[model samples]
Target: MEGVFDLERVATFVAGYQSVMSLESAHLADTARRLWWKRMTDFWQLEFHYDRNDDSCDELYIADEALLHWWTERLDVVERTFAGSAQVPNSP
Candidate 1:
């Protein structure tokens, strides 16, 4: 998650492809899949600072939007689940 938002191909991937099952839409609000996107975004191009373990390094061609969308999916799923859940009866 360091130095992200610089630029990546994920946005183009999502915009070009609209398939929900595909990687493009796998992290969309509908599917609620984030494990993949998170993995990608969290990746850093440590090639330059691998030895030093510097976090202020550039991302490995990651998209900040991709991460944002991916994270939002979790909230979206949670909200939907709670919104549709039936009220639980209180047992005194």
Candidate 2:
């Protein structure tokens, strides 16, 4: 996995968000799963770089795809970290 995105950063970000915004652990976990699924099913990055001949988002696409794999391999840890970081009350 690339160093572009990591669990610690995500956890820290979620914790920071919780300081100002109220978030539910289940909601966050669900959203993360959905996003991962979307990426798993999408070819937009390839389309963009090949079909559309645009390379502007290449780096982002690469990073996101890498993160997708990273997250998939650590789904449980991701959920737990997100839940803990968000400090959501009584999340299952």
Q: CA lDDT of each candidate?
A: 0.41, 0.71
Best by lDDT: 2
Cα misplacement distance, residue 6 of candidate 1 (Å): 17
Clashing pairs in 2: none
Mark the regions of model 2 whose C-alpha exceeds 4 Å error after superposition.
1-4, 53-64, 85-92
- Segments in model 1 whose C-alpha atoms lie over 4 Å from true places: 1-31, 35-37, 46-48, 51-70, 77-92
State how far residue 55 of model 2 sits from its true place (Å).
Answer: 5.8
* C-alpha lDDT of residue 64 in model 1: 47
The stretch of ten residues in a row with the least summed lDDT in candidate 1 is 83-92
